[model samples]
Target: MKLSNEVKFNYPREDIWKALHDPEILKHAIPGCEGLTLQEDGSYDVSMSLGVAAVKGKYNGKVYMTDIEKPNKYLLEAEGSGSPGHVSMKMDCNLEETEEGCLLKWDCDAEIGGKIAGVGSRALGGIAKFMAKKFFDDIKKQLKKGAYTN
Candidate 1:
């Protein structure tokens, strides 16, 4: 599946970039996130529980950030598995400074297998979009409240 979207934040691009790299900020920003640990190799080990449509399970994943150009763009590659199925995604994220604040744009390619894939692509796509929106919204709220300090 392919997913793309953009989100605007009321904070500076540098601040947003710092928040994005912070595991504590991400644990709160990500929906259903239970834990996030940054590895020595710069990847993150994540644990999350999610329920979407007919799929519900706890997932353990490793997220790798690559091609980083600091406060500009990067690639996120993740792979996870649970009792329901397995999922892998590669997302390219871009941060653009705007007059008001900043805009975060992302495009993702994802693959799924097992029971979750049986739920149909349309349903899976909708679930993915919803989750992404929630994540961004949480981040925006945290930023507005000065939840992260530089």
Candidate 2:
């Protein structure tokens, strides 16, 4: 599946970039994240427990940030598996500076296999979008509360 979205942030691009990379902030924003550890190799180890309908399960995965352009853009790649199924995604994330703050945009390509894939593409698409929105909203709330992850 492929999905795209843009979120407006009332914070500076630099600040948004920092928040996105901060492990604590990411752990807080990721809907079901149990742990987010930054590895010395610049990758992240993630553990998540999700109870969302047919996709409910505990997942462990590694995420890699590549093609980084500092406070501008980067590629996020992740793959995880659980009792329900397996999922992998590659998302291009961009942060553009705007007059008010920052405009964060992302385009993602994802693949799923096993029981989870049985949920149908349309349903999965909606779920992915919902999860994405929650993630961004959580970040926005943190920024507003001055919860600087770094």
Candidate 3:
């Protein structure tokens, strides 16, 4: 599946970039995310429960950030598994400063296997896109509320 979205945050680009690197901010932004731990070597362990549109399950995943250009762009690769199936996804992200705030552009590709693949691929894409938008909106709100103190 391929997904893309653009969101504008009501903060400076630097602050938004910092929030993106903060585990706490990430945990809060992801729907049903229970916890996020940032390991010393640029790896992250994430625990999350997902019940979006057509799929419901708990996932434990590791994400690695690469091709990072701090405060500007990066690539994220992640994989997770659950009783229903497994998910592997990759995303390329770009951030640009706007007079009002910052504009974020995200492009992603994902694949599902096992039971989750039984759901229609088109339906799955829609569901995943919705979830992604929700996640970004959550992050924007948190930043607006001064939730990321760091």
Best by lDDT: 2
Cα lDDT computed for each candidate against the true fold: 0.91, 0.92, 0.86
Per-residue CA lDDT of model 1 for 50-130, tens digit only, reads 876778999999999999999899999999989889999999999999998889999999999988999999999998999
User: All candidates: CA RMSD in angstroms?
Assistant: 1.2, 1.6, 1.8
Clashes of each: 0, 0, 0
lDDT at position 32, candidate 1: 91
Per-model TM-score on C-alpha atoms: 0.96, 0.96, 0.92
Worst 10 residues of 2 by lDDT: 141-150
Model 3 steric clash pairs = none
Position 49, candidate 2: lDDT: 93
Error of 2 at 91 (Å): 0.3
User: What TM-score does prediction 1 earn?
Assistant: 0.96
> What's model 3's lDDT at 54?
63
Give the clashing residue pairs of candidate 2, or none: none
- Per-residue C-alpha lDDT of model 2 across residues 1-150, encoded as one tens digit per residue: 999999999888999999999998999999999999999999999999986565689999999999999989999999999998899999999999999999999999999988889989998899899999999999999898886533
